[model samples]
Target chain A: MSNYLSLENVGITFKTQNGPFRALDDVSIKIEKGEYVTMIGHSGCGKSTVLNIVAGLLTATEGVVLLENKEVNAPGPDRAVVFQNHSLLPWLTVYENVRLGVDKVFAKTKSKAERDEWTKHNLKLVHMEHAMDKRPGEISGGMKQRVGIARALAMEPKVLLMDEPFGALDALTRAHLQDSVMEIQAELGNTVIMITHDVDEAVLLSDRIVMLTNGPSATIGEILTVDLPRPRNRLALAEDPHYHHLRGQVLEFLYHRQLRPAA
Target chain B: MKSNIVRLTPQQESPPEESTAVIPESASNAASTATRATKSVEKIPASTTRNYALWRASGTTLIKNIFLPVLTFLVVGVIWSYIHSHIAPEIPSIADTWTRAKEILADPLAQNGPNDMGIGWQVLYSLGRVLGGFALAAIVGIPVGFVMGMSENFQKAVQPLIQILRPVSPLAWLPIGLLLFKAVNPSAIFVIFITSIWPMIMNTAAGVKAIPKDYMNVAAVLRLGKLEITRKILLPATLPHVITGMRLSLSIAWMVIVAAEMLTGGIGIGFYVWDEWNNLNVPSIIVAIFIIGIVGIILESVMTLVHRHFDYSR
Candidate 1:
């Protein structure tokens, strides 16, 4: 399959007062166009660091991130990130936050009317059109995340980088939002790379689940293909025969290794 | 998750009591006790009454929290009046202070000296000076603070100088201001400017530096232009702290103005207080002191309200 984005021999080392800590180690992955890939790992396993590298918010200590055959040297509108905390500007209304991205990336290209229409369309897609005038503080956590997703989509990014976008939500809200995001991704046909810790979330939402090992220089431990057919139901997926096998394999690979001593 | 638990009821009942076998003694006793309680509830049909009691408990907690402070204030007032009447007649009772306060208000212009103008005019004059000095400080300090916060090189270069100047007394700037401006009002304004600026600068810088990293990431990914990001992200993000700083600075400005007026001897409430004290008019001096306190409280409260108005989040 042709690749839309690629991370080649990518790694990161953060310099601290104590010493340097390697966050990622020679990690390489290729994402195909319109493909949904989930990176599942324990916290501090360099999952977010990898997403930051991909979003060009942080540079890799080694290797290159190529998007559509071009190197990503800095952050650009081609990749939009939805942070775990839903970093909506509390001062701004929901519409203004989404309009922020549209105005920034498409100002020279789109008219005022077009921008407004685009913002409203995206808000509507997230079912936040009614709350467009409300400030971020006035909305619930779930609504804020929806606004964040709307803002990311309004950028019309070629690749969407989601760092545990639903990690903070209640399970039911998370599940509903997951379905909403999946439906949107399908509709928009944009490549999505989501970082998550929930095994069921990874299995239900991704074409491939990439698991990373524990840190002190972490790398991809295994990549599991989720053979379950879409559109997925979390309840049904839990009961499916393949679901247990896949869950067991990932759990064993990630945790069982921790029980073994160094070679 | 709620539905999941509810849907598992049949399965739970059909498990041949396997879960009971796995349960330890303490847990089984707890569950059995809870089951007995639920059966009792079913027999009585009084769970709704228990729920009503629970609701009342929450309501009582809410009312107690709100009423407690007001009750404390009333009790304090009674003790204050008792102490005033019994121990020291020299001490102004709350009613005496209020009467004097109302008398002053009834004829503020006449109570104020003919040459002194009115208390109203003095208040306005004092307000203008405070605002002028504070506004000047904000205009100059915020941008400097933003730059200092955003750039490491700039922060390192200027930080030591700021730290050195910040601790210098407002009076120390008075002499410099007098020499530089060569006029009483302007010099006094300058002193107020100097005295009030450091907090605004320091607090603004702190606010800017403390901005969440996630916001910068959002700005970067969205390709927000520098101007847009500064307006939308940087400015609004720092506003709460900025308002807090301004509140602090306004009080400082009022204090510095009073000191400045005392030193400079101008037509201001500060000067009025000094003038009354110099003339040894004890009652008017007392009046001036009370007025000053009241005005200061009002100004502080106004700033606080403005701060709260803009501060949406808890």
Candidate 2:
């Protein structure tokens, strides 16, 4: 399969009061079309920096990001991002939040009825159609994240970039929404790159899991392909014979091979 | 509550498992228990009706939230009436003030000439000046605040100048304003502008600076245009602070307009009060004072309501 997205030797250095601090060092990755990839790392390991670079939020100090064989220079409607806090504008109702993407990119091309229909379809896909009239503040965190998901999905983006979308959720809620995300991804078959800290979550939802080292400057430590059967259940995945093996290997790579002492 | 629910059923009822096993031994007791259970279930709907009614109740729920200020006003009025009747018997009573208020309302400028300053005319004049000065401040302050907020170098360079201007009182500027404007009203308005704009600009700059990195990241990722981002993201994010700055600006503007009028000599409520005091009409001065207070309260409430419109994240 042809790679739909490519990050070539991407590096980021932030200018601080003291001096320039390198956040990411010559990191590179290629993601295939319809790939569901999870980027796993410790905090400040530049996982989010990488995601932002790919999303065109930040220009890399070196190298380039390619989307569909074109250089990615800025954020566009074609690539949507779901933030960690589920940054649904609190002033807007669920319908309005999802319709924001539609309004931004598709308002000129589609009728109001068409837009409404599309919004409902995405909301229903995330099981939040009942909440379409409610503001983000009125909903629970899980529901807000689901609305964030629905908003991203409604864009019909070429790539969906998520920065720990479920990080703030309760364990049970996170798992439930993780499965919901997987189900939607399966239905839509869009490319997704999610930044996360949870190892089991990365394994359960990803086609491949890429782990990053600790940072003053960090790079991808290892990329592991998840060979688990499709339609995976989290409970069963934990009990699966291969689960322990993969988990052990990843933990070793994260805590042993790329370990850094406390600062 | 769970155990209470489980234990509350009549003991004579046949065990649920045994009955479901297709062999019931106590048919008569079971029937009575079922009837009793039906009665309890019927009561559940009545309780739910009470709950539904409770759910429908709307608006303020506490004295502090709703009626405390009104009660305090009543208490203060009672004390004022008592003092007027006994301690200062010659002082005008609330009744006399009410009559004066009505007369003032009937023909605000009647006591004076065609251009004589009526209470209503004085209030309108003061309000106009306050609004004019506050509007000018908002126009100049908000944009400067946004620029100072977004640029670190600009913030560092300009911050000291802002600090120097902040401590200079509006009253202190009155003479300079009069010299600059060469007109009493414009001079007074200028004082209002100076006093009001500083806090507004500073607060707005602080609010803009406090916008989270995550929000900027989202803006960048979405590739939102600078204009679009300002309107859609930055403006909304800083709304609470902007509204707060506006509140501070308006109140300061109101106060400065009165002070400026006292210094510059004008046809505003402030000048009216000073004029009445000079004539030794303490009662009219008192009335003017109360009117000023009432107007300030009204203006503040209006600003608060407007603030509520933008405070959705709460």
In terms of lDDT, the poorest run of 10 residues in model 2 chain A is: A254-263
Best by TM-score: 1
Clash pairs, model 1 backbone: none
List chain B TM-scores, each candidate: 0.69, 0.75
Colliding pairs, model 2: none
Tens-digit lDDT string for candidate 1 (A8-63): 99999999999998889989989899889999887778899899899898999999
lDDT of 2 by residue, B1-314 (tens): 32223433433333333212222323333344444554666777765653343333211222232365568779988988999987987567787877767766777755465347678888888999888888898899988899888998999999999889899887888889778988777877788888778878888898898888767765665566889889888898888888899998898788777777776666788888788767766677678888888799778878887997888764
Model 2 Cα lDDT, one tens digit per residue, A25-88 = 9798899999999998778788999988888878899989999899988887678899999888
lDDT of 1 at B92: 64
Give the Å error, residue B204, model 1.
Answer: 0.8
